[model samples]
Target: MRGRLIGQTVAVMAVGLLAAAIDGCSRRVTPEDFAEGEGATAPAEMSPQQERSSAQPTGAPEKAVTATDPGGNRNHQPGDKEPLEGVTESTPSAIQGGDSSPEPTTRVSRAQRTGGVAERPQGRPVQGEEQAGAVAPQVDQSQGLGDQAVEATPTVAPADAIPIDQPEERPQLAEGAAAADGTDDGRPAGASTAEPFNPLRAGRAGMGPLRSEGAGGEGHPAFRPASTEASHEGGRQSKKYDPIAENGPIFVGWPKPQLALVLTGCQNGYLEPCGCAGLDRMKGGLGRRHTFMSELRNKRSWPVVALDVGGLIKGFGRQAEMKFHTTVSAMQLMQYETIALGANDLRLPAAELLAVAAPVDGKTLFVSGNVALFKFEYGMTARYEVIRAGGRKVGVTAVLGKSFQQKINNPELEIIAPEEALAELVPVLKPQCDLLVLLAHASRDESIALGKAFPEFDVVVTAGGPAEPPLDLAHIDGTSALLVEVGQKGMYAVVLGFYQDEAVRYQRVPLDSRFPYSPDVKLLMVNYQDQLRQVGFEGLGVRPVPHSRREELGAYVGSQKCQSCHEVSYRVWRKSGHARAWRTLVHLDPPRTHDPECVSCHVVGWNPEYYYPYETGFWSEEKTPELVDVGCESCHGPGEAHVKAEMGSDLALQRKLQQAVTLTLEDAKKQQCITCHDGENSPDFKFETYWPKIEHREWEDE
Candidate 1:
């Protein structure tokens, strides 16, 4: 019975196979039948490549692709060519499964795959069908027939069905999601993985490394522009005749006057010019200012009434405190009668301010009408002071504006509004003096309003205005009060000369090189430098901070180490002015080696922008002799990593080090050079002219 059953099963199987073979032979198989999503299998005799080619969806055209060679040249394959507009070329790793080995592969653009039509739903109609209002066919996705679902969808290819050859062409994935290639690394799709470009890097093609702008990295101490009239060559004084000498006498046509009111303020802690570029280029300094005042009193033999509408220092710290004291002492030596405190001045500790304002030789020098310490008026400051000038009583009062009052955060300080303070005081003080002056540490508009509101003030010396004040005095509309603005950084002074019969002449004087440096002020500067040296950098409130690129670039190794491999470039730098920067400071009448402001620009390891030292920056000649002067590291960044890389046998590391130090000429012009050659220091600095002087390279033929 078992043998009969087996024979019957074998006969049934043979008949079924024979019947299927006959049915298949009745019809011929076509490429359309093997189209993707149709569920039709390829013929047994077809090769894998041919099978893939036939697997393409029906109606999709074959596209020609460009293959990249090892030399980066491209070769085109034979097919219908499609324009590759808007397609970014992918790396070999992106297309070839983490294998960067040079191998030719077809490159297909997103546009080519979609037949010049933007991707849409798989079965959705094109623009032509949409215009005709053709309805989309529905797909039964629940049936789990992938081919049927694909066939029912419209124009857009299924997102997951991107061809293996075009991985980069895949649609953008959600941010932080893995890409089709599985190397997204959490970055947004298509984001670059290379390091950001730094223009300041050294040895860069087309541009050389950075060069220090001034002797000491600090540049000019004052915030004034260089004089256009004067020009210097080869570090010498201008051969051209001095403009101030040829321009005839100052205050050109003003008649002889009884009293000269010399106005100066907004010193901003510039005791003297750095004089790095040349004295002729610099405009204002305390030394030059004193000479101007001295000439008014002794040379012209005119009675002088010196005053300052204050903004004494720029920054706050121990350095600022010292600068404040030095400025006040210098003002006293110039015989300034009154100094009005500005917002910047009020930032100082209240106790320190009171001490500075205290009377010297039984005479108060600082005055403010609205400010109070601990909510009560104290110290040497008074609401108003009457002074005898030009044989007439002059009433002077100062008020801090309401706008500036908001900037102060000290709980111990109390500030009354400028208008309110002036209102109460003006009524009482106006009758006592023949000339009334208001020192308004306020905005220009507020000053004008005060002048217009009270009309009793004869002159208003305002703090805010253009850096260069107008030649003529401004009068408040509908009021006789004159508005006087002495420009910022103490670059210019507005002198009001009062003569018999109330005749007042206005002269705006630029404290240029025409005025000689005052010996008295020079002594003060020497003393100030001495004080800074004793206090040291740390004592002056400056501490070393880590370099921004410390880990990658490493610590500075000076220019000498760089000299071994770069002899030609080193020789060029040796002869350049930067190498002799330290000598310039030492040769000055009063040596500035001890001065942090001067030393920062002249030496290595200091950040020129902040005027502070880096972790391994120059401190003193004895401690950091090798790091002295503006060395190679100033521009190229620290060289420890670069040096190690170059000395090693690794060719790849050497190439990377070379690239790391490279700087571009455009970057040097826009970023690196400006740090030192700013308006105040290198006023006559034009990159086109200056660059040629220090231009150097390893290969002269290039």
Candidate 2:
């Protein structure tokens, strides 16, 4: 579950990773490598030896630490597990050496080693190291695999619970949580040593016991309220989940972006009902686009732009949606200079969308070559414009695909073969613009055809069509043109980077809604939540909850204080990354830092804290546990009944295991890691520096 986010650094080992003092030290045990992963820890926090370990060529930022726990030694499986059995470190194992910027290459999956046996059916080396028909082992076994692997189970829940001693930033619940008996019992707020805390009831109602309501007097769980407190605790030493601090927009020294395009609006039969793609809600807002775009822009000087290739929100019977779907809203938030009309966005009886987009302050430009202004016929207009930057002029425009003409509504909108339209236009318009950039909501096949139809064009940024994992750049008539897309609901954006001229080539970068937040955006999010809720989108399956999952647990608690005895886990919970998912986005202190833009994914507290006004940054009024980071409610569901169930002794380990549902094993671990790893969610997440140290006695894999 290695994640990608802006400013996250990877180690090439030694020179590649920058470890200052990790080599030659005795090995220590690290916490179980939960499927989820992290960034290199902060420099200031690294132990001298640990720092040296990072400087290795293996690119692994972390090395096993010297065992401090009374238990055996570090890096050994808890049950001994026979030294990982027959496995040995393989060759070309993603070693970073001194190189940080890795030109993207095909690599193997991490699951191959972590869980799934490597696909290799090993055979003896042909002769010696001499190659005969040796299939060089590919794919690194550390980063996990592709595909959102969700290990689904009947999710039982505990009250929103977190450790108290953790950073004030950790997620937590109320104090005096319930035991098997519903009566409030004392539980350690921050210790992982406490007995299993399970809820009394089952289903969503059973998770109440884990919530931490009464541990601290302030009602806010006890943890990092200020940096001074952390400084007092040996400066950076006491911090459990500390992030490695680094500066970015580092184009010259980082890996080029890997890109993907996913379309979501089409019905199985064609264009009809919308699909959630199984997501709880759709989150494609224009403002969000700006952050993702800015990140990609900062990644490379290569030209990058995202366009709504159409169909997204097309079925929204609402006026704003029909009229170019916040076309104005998108225009306002989407910083791209060019926009093409998706059939759904343009099929409105009236074209008010054009007016809405007409005067959106110059930076956002519009384009369409196949549609006549106010006519049902095809004619070119000043719809899209190109830019001459870095000595290259890339002309941008759009045309509805022929299939859309009168197929649905708005027969007045003319549609033509994309090839026909481009053929008629590119030659005539070729000299008018330097690079031809098409904003088509057409399918991938059509996009490919369009690219081939006109060798005159340079790049195609499309949306609205369904696609597979990710598509790379393709050549059309010997010129370089690439296809770009972002999955529906603003989940991701595909950024293409090209430099100098047509023959120079380009690379694709990926941008998603995971980055630091600004105050202004926070206020807007609050308003949007209310708006969506008012529009009946809250329980609409995937509509996002403005608060984190933890807050929901808090509100679920029936004024019963759950933090009387179980104090340790609750305290440690505060420092967990889960609690701070929302805060990182709005905090933004670590410029180009980690943060989460989506609120629904976080476990919130009982309180909803966020207010993003336009002019100002995230105002204090809008900040809350749900928006700030991991809260007790994240892991737990609402807790009122679970408290009662605990009062009844219904809590059990069996019940607890059934309740924690996540995409993949790695996904679940990643979620847990989100409680602290930096970059997007944990911008400062460092491996060797802050990775929990441990020791274990080897045992047979039972």
Candidate 3:
């Protein structure tokens, strides 16, 4: 596929060059023009005495002009028996050198010849003869298309024509040439080396090839002067992806990019995808995201402003606090400009969060419109923030959803409705900044509603709720406001390009196995983990026990143990989707099978501290291989006692096992499957639709 793609690119370039060469010969060059070295002389701009003496007599015999074809290798010289293909010799009325009887005139360009060489004087550069900073004059059809007409009338080019290609001897400095005072050579006089021209690189010069205006230049009649069209072609060549050329914004000319905003959301205290590496490595976390942002900043070298919808830390423990601090400190090094407030961060004590949220080196600001501590402290939480980026004032504000606001009841914290907060904040922020952005950590529907209500906002970035695919630039139907969202966790980052007087363009970059971890962030994670082991959760002022307190559920027995009686059922479970859920995480970078949030659905009977009930379940790899994924025990009840009772001589225990084991198909389809297959994890889940894929009850105990 790669080879085919490269071949296609080369083929396209070849065709374009062939067409350009043909266009170059639109007004053919003859040998008599080259014999006299018409195009080889210096500029024809001379005194009246010099011009009068150079004119030839009208009665002079015509010079023998050789016709060279622009075809395959071979020269077509004077008087070949077979005139060059599609070409016939003809002489001007005054000069008679060819056959007297009129021959058919073939209006063929020099490009039509199958084998012909270009005729020009030796040691003359094709592009250097034309005066720098001068436009080529319009063609005079009555005088014919050749060097004679151009030499007779010398003219200075327009101010904009070929300005950058002006010779070193020009009076004024050209647009792109080296400083006049610096060096005698046209290159920069200083020791600073000249860099290769790149359209995407900031503060660079020489965007395209220089050409004279109109069609005649340096004794060539067919060539037209370079314009924005050349710059556009140069831009297309510089980048692998040219959004402008690919049905995106149609830029009139080269426009400098102002700023690049890298956006993120819902980190959930994930230092790495999981600790595992190799094939099991998972994507995302601070390490990979930092790597992506840093690399992009270095390449573009534009002002990179990073914003997050928040939720950096997932839990309330010393580990979570340290992780949050580490993540924020790394973000500071990464040069993040602003971060919106999320409810997850508010779960921590006011003092700890305040210390962490404090401006890092007075650069990264935390913006929130509704979130406030102890009746809205100005220093802790402001209604909005105005920041100048790439010479433009940008306003940033955040609003937490009502669902999240209800989680905080402490009188020290005050949460206002997003609508109320925006009503007061929008008017002030709109007037202060060129672009206004609101971080709306709410449901998708709620975010859209906010965009419609506040058309003054230029962008709305949503966080929380079911992880959604990156959204396109969606307008409010009646307003100019646009809405977009990144998936949950730091799995994706939206890179936005801001240009002067143009709509913002964005690309959704997925932080997956393809991206590598930053060494600095990786080192930070290692140190944080080391600290975690030394001072456990209890030492960090967090409850060490699981959140779910339920203890009535039965113990899990290995699926292999069930094979003794229900051999067919075990085979069916082995082939089902549930059996390989753990491996799915293992295949992902950093292997997220160990992650509590991911493991809950992938593995059987997982119980994280924040949600769900605790039960005897798969503890670790070495201890519970059978309970690794959803097996018989996951859909049915735990089978340790049930399996033992059937094998033992206890009549009463066996009777209890029979009753507990008889779960109707409806029970499993309606409730058992829906538990883990709901939003965020599986948005398209339909229990009745999906149950048939794994339904296996053909075999039962006699």
TM-score (all chains, Cα) for each model: 0.64, 0.38, 0.50
Q: How well is each residue in 498-594 modelled by candidate 2, as lDDT tens digits? A: 2111112122222211233334444544444444434532233222333333322223331123354235544444444433444433343221111
Among the numbered candidates, top TM-score falls to: 1
Please provide, for model 1 over 1-702, each residue's C-alpha lDDT reduced to its tens digit, 9 standing for 90 to 100: 999999999999999999989887865574323221100111121111100001112333322111111112121122212211111111111221223322212221111111122221111111111211222233221211011111111111111332334332222333243422353221222222111111111111110011111011221111101111111111323444242422112342232345567787777877776576666556689887888786655434455777788889977888888889889888888888788888888899877787787555545777777876665334446556767755555678888888878877777677888878777777765555556788988876687788878877867888876665443344454444566777788887778765432124455666766677789988888888888888988798888889887888888888999989998788867766778777767777677777777777788888876678888878888988988877788777888888998788998887777767766678879998788878776665677866765676542343
Task: Kindly provide the TM-score of model 1 when superposed on the true structure, using C-alpha atoms.
Answer: 0.64
Those runs of model 3 whose alpha carbons end farther than 4 Å from true positions after fitting are: 1-256, 266-285, 313-323, 326-330, 360-364, 375-378, 401-404, 416-432, 442-456, 464-466, 469-471, 524-605, 608-636, 650-659, 662-701
Candidates 1 and 3: which is better by TM-score?
Answer: 1
C-alpha RMSD between model 3 and the true structure = 27.2
Better of 1 and 2 by TM-score: 1
Where is the poorest 10-residue window by lDDT in model 3?
84-93
Tell me the spans in candidate 1 whose CA falls farther than 4 Å from its real position. 1-238, 241-248, 360-362, 698-702
Looking at candidate 2, what is the lDDT of residue 163?
Answer: 23
User: What lDDT is obtained when candidate 2 is compared to the true structure?
Assistant: 0.32
After TM-score superposition, the amount by which residue 540's alpha carbon in candidate 2 deviates from its true location, in angstroms, is: 12
